[model samples]
Target chain A: MDKVILAKDVSLSYDSNQTIIKQATFSIESGSFVFVTGASGSGKSTLLKSLYGAIKPKQGSLIVGGVELNNVSKSKLNFLRRHLGIVFQDYKLIKEWTIEKNITMPLLINGYEKEVTLNQAESLLKHVRLKHQAGKYPMELSGGEQQRVAMARALSHNPILILADEPTGNLDEYSSQLIWNLLEGANTQLKTTVIVVTHHIPSTLNVDYKHYHIEYGEISEIN
Target chain B: MKSIKNHLSLIVALISILFSIQVFIVVERSIDAYKENLAKNYSVVVVSEKRIANSEFLSIDGLINRVEELSPDNIINRLNTGMDQKNINLLKLTLPKFYKLYLTKFPTPKEITTLRKNLFSNPSISKIEDFSNNHDITYKLLVLFKGVILVFAIVVSIVTMLLILKELRIWQFKHSERMSIMGLFGAPTWLRSAVLFRLSIVDAIISSILIYLIFMYISTNRFVLQQFDNINIKVVIFDTLNDFFLLLGVSLVLSILLATMIVLGHKEEV
Candidate 1:
């Protein structure tokens, strides 16, 4: 199997005395669905940040998409992150842009022309059932609608890896089921790697994915 | 590419408008000053000879000079009811053999600054040295005023460009809805920002045209020309226009530079 992510003794800390995730090691295989769960401050978000190259490991080496985390150049980080879709807890949508334009934001950044960008944005919006909200601004949309738009933008370029941080943390039951189904679709149909960080573990666990628990600053496979 | 093109057009238009408005201000101000200087200082002086007997002094021949009689006459005066040279002899013929010196009060002090500008030394000298402090005051004020307007125009453009650039950044950031687009498509950050900044440059150009129209309307009024006769408003105006154009040129180049920076500086982290 292709190794999409590998970490060996990856320790991260904001200050000298307190280490967030200390001497922790784990590897996530390519094309696999994984759910990471822990208490409120168990460094789940930090781990996701490290994978997307947001937070650098303080000590030890780690790799994502075959790029080492230590001394990773910004340009290289950008290149690596293009393949990893990160869904923030807050949705992180630009308030000024319309929903359709937001979905194709990645494509536009990568120099795609308008017609093609629009088509891709439209296709993704259709997948998320928000084709009608293309011209509307983020602030005009509901909390769940913003997250769905964000997810469409993340998947617009067909990223090989998906990193979702509490995608349904603030959603209603209807919206939560909608987001989960979208993630499941991407994982099974496209063979895309999905890693979701959430506090609540769904009872059903609909998709076939490994469960990892973070406790006392160490990661261990639970199921 | 289309976005880049749009931005370039915008920057060009703004600089052109700003430069033209400043040029118009210079022209209007100069004309007003010239007219006033001519009106207030146009006077004739009659003088009695220094060493004449009372009888000789009284005669028109004994009087050294009368300035109004010698000034250049134009076609407007030729058409007037008063004929040239006839007005002169009529006054002379009626004069008594004894000359009575008719002098305007406080002569040199009033137009002394104008005299210096014309480089006229010994202009009907009564007493040479003493001069009013106010004679030089207008000159100082006009110079300072011109200096200030020029600097203000430049500073305003620079600051406006900065603010416009910031707005463009935020606009582009929102326009890039596909947060993954930055990474996935291998697109450089400058492209989106270039498009948005270009729009602001266009707005600057539009605002400049509006300012020019405002100046054009104000220029038609014959404003305080006589009040500022001692100073050359033209010199100040032309100097200012030159500076204004130069500054506009600099602003265009700087805005383009700033747009480029915005393009390159946009974030990659989504």
Candidate 2:
């Protein structure tokens, strides 16, 4: 019904050296599963960072769920992050804490009490098929298993939008298909807007998703 | 907020150390003071080469007349014949020597040891005049302890900060990502600081409990406080508490400063 994420004339650069995506613009609608594909260093991760307010755009504006990203207040940024589910390229789960604890992190940050968070985490662990590894740390789990935990952690707070840097970059075919199924489940069950960034486009991703490509500092939606 | 639960272990650790150290210093000082008082009183009756026995061999009228005629500040305590004064030659003790007397409700082993040292090789003094109206060994102990506690607090504070700082040094480079997650977790600045403050308070409580138990145990023993009556025990216990608070207060303050510095400094990137 409304734009879940939007960027107008957005540009990002480091040290005034070079601008990667100049005058780039796009809007992601709610309840959409979008795949972002690009060659190496096409600013896909940078775009996601901008959406989560981790990086301030050098020019123009980026809005997530109607809140401005450029020079936004920290309180508002925190509130924005509360509703956002971001997965890093390396599946940034804390190594010391267990899988369940990692999954409950966002909710814990959002100030949900222990019992509520625990119940939700338990359910999410079951949903992700990591129920047996609830108490296992991230390092103990395989790459695919860790990715699943990351995805579950991203989805734990019931966030409106999930931005995954690379959902299945290093996973096996079985794990990749499992990740896709989990993504599809969230999209259908919770109507969550999901944006997945990847350099690979396996032939198996057929969930009625929109496709976008990043090339030569520009973005375009594929027909 | 999540870090609070995480840091509870550290808090408990800090509290335990502080509690033990506090109790140790208190008991140590108490023992030293008790011995000192005993030694002071022993210095009077024990025949020693270091001190001259000021026995009043003259008649009562003469002794009284001479003592009264002397300086008004001089105080004389009359010795009864029933005391264990037999075979104790007061005249052989070193004469014309000043003795620091601590009149306590109980005998102190430290005072005894020290007075024994001073009077060990010399004759014992019999008749005595108390020139200084200084308080008992317990009071002197409390006063001296006020400084010792301050120093101990400073040492403990420095040690705790250095330990935390050292751990943080490793965490900064190796576990910075973890720190960022904690910062991003919506835990308040004060709450983060409370991690360290909680440790200090924990330390204080543990130290207080330990010191109190130790005092109750050691002071209750008739052997430990052989010189003091029950009333004196109560007074010493009451006064030791005063000493404990003074130390605890300093330790809390030091911990607060260190915890704030470390938490704030570590919150940001390197």
Candidate 3:
């Protein structure tokens, strides 16, 4: 398999005064489901942010989808981001827009035709089992339903990679299970590289996967 | 309700600016018309050694339009009752030639001085009466009125523009979150700011229409028309097509420019 994300001696930080991730080196294969488990303040989220160009890696080379993120220009960074999807811990759906419109956001940004985007959004709504709530606002939906909508939106453009930050951290068991199943399906069926950062990984994922544990500001890949 | 509150400052600014501009135009037109009316009735009295013709008066620096020789018949007729016709005729000839010089328009104080110098430069002319005291006071008052209106218009425009800019910044801040979310999704700057642009354009159109109604009502009001009639000057109150297009153009351009400034500011911060 080809490598989708390559980080060599990557050190991430919010400001120059304090470093979070120190000289971390790792590579994740394309079409692989990878979980990054860490204690609180272990810099897992910072590392995930670097992949999406939200945070520039300090003194390292971080590449995603064939684009180097460190010191990249804004336009180039946006271009790279268009090929990637991200699911935040808090869903982050626009409060004013309807669920269907939320899912169509990435497609719209990609300049897809209106009719084509609408159809894709409808199909995705059905996939996420929220077709009944398509016309409802994000605030009108339950927490679980909103997260599912976010997940559907993340996959709407069929991006090459998906970075999810604690997608199920605030969800119930049923929602957590559904989110994991969706992430697993994206990796196996859609062949999209999935990188998830979470405090705990469910033991019931009956599929081949990789786990990397972060402790003491260092990442070590484990079985 | 919320949308209206958001655009309150913008609407106020646009209305004030439009009002000032319209008033400025109308007042300037009115003053020119009034001056023209006054010009028709005012003239300078001159005593010349020889009779001055209308053409000669027009030729000398073109300061005056026409010259009329004043008839000595009335004064001579009254004196003839006390003296003989021969003595009266002799007195009329001996009397220095009296002429009235009509001006083209009401002249400014400086222009009046120029006209006096030009008239005095003529060797045939001896004395000229321009009613300097009255002319001086009228001219000064008109100039002061015009200056006040101009200053008022300028101040209103500048202050209103700043208010409009500040209102636009507030709208930008209010919509920043939605814009940022769209930006993270790889939306271009124009697409993300579509809402703000739409808001500004709509507000511009609304304020322009409101200003139009206001000026139109004032244009046809009894008091305003009466004032023009009192001065015996026929001035155009409004030109619908020209003024409408001008106001609309100004409104659209101002709104778009302010919105663009806000958008650029947001981009730089990002």
* Cα lDDT for residue A218, candidate 2: 88
Please report, as a value between 0 and 1, the fraction of native contacts recovered by candidate 1.
0.33
**The candidate that achieves the highest TM-score relative to the unseen native structure:** 3
TM-score of 2: 0.66
Model 2 misplaced stretches (Cα beyond 4 Å):
B1-160, B170-176, B182-259, B266-270
> Which model is ahead, 1 or 2, in terms of lDDT?
2
Q: Taking the tens digit of each residue's C-alpha lDDT, what string does model 1 give over B72-183?
A: 2343355457656777555444432222232233233435444333322323323222223543454455456667776766676676656656655664455444333444
Residue by residue across A1-223, what tens digits does model 2's lDDT show?
A: 7999888999986548888778778888999999898987998887877777767889998888889988888678777877888777788787767889889988877889999999999998997788998988889899999998888888888889999898899998877887888788888889999999998766775567888898987888997
* lDDT, candidate 2, at B82: 47
In the order shown, what is each candidate's alpha-carbon RMSD?
10.1, 10.3, 2.9
**Model 1 quality (TM-score):** 0.66
- Please list the residue runs of candidate 1 whose C-alpha ends up more than 4 Å from where it truly belongs after superposition: B1-188, B219-270
The lDDT-based order of candidates, best leading, equals: 3, 2, 1
Model 3 residue runs over 4 Å out of place are A129-145, A173-178, A203-207, B1-9, B77-91, B267-270
Q: Which candidate gets the maximum DockQ versus the true structure?
A: 3
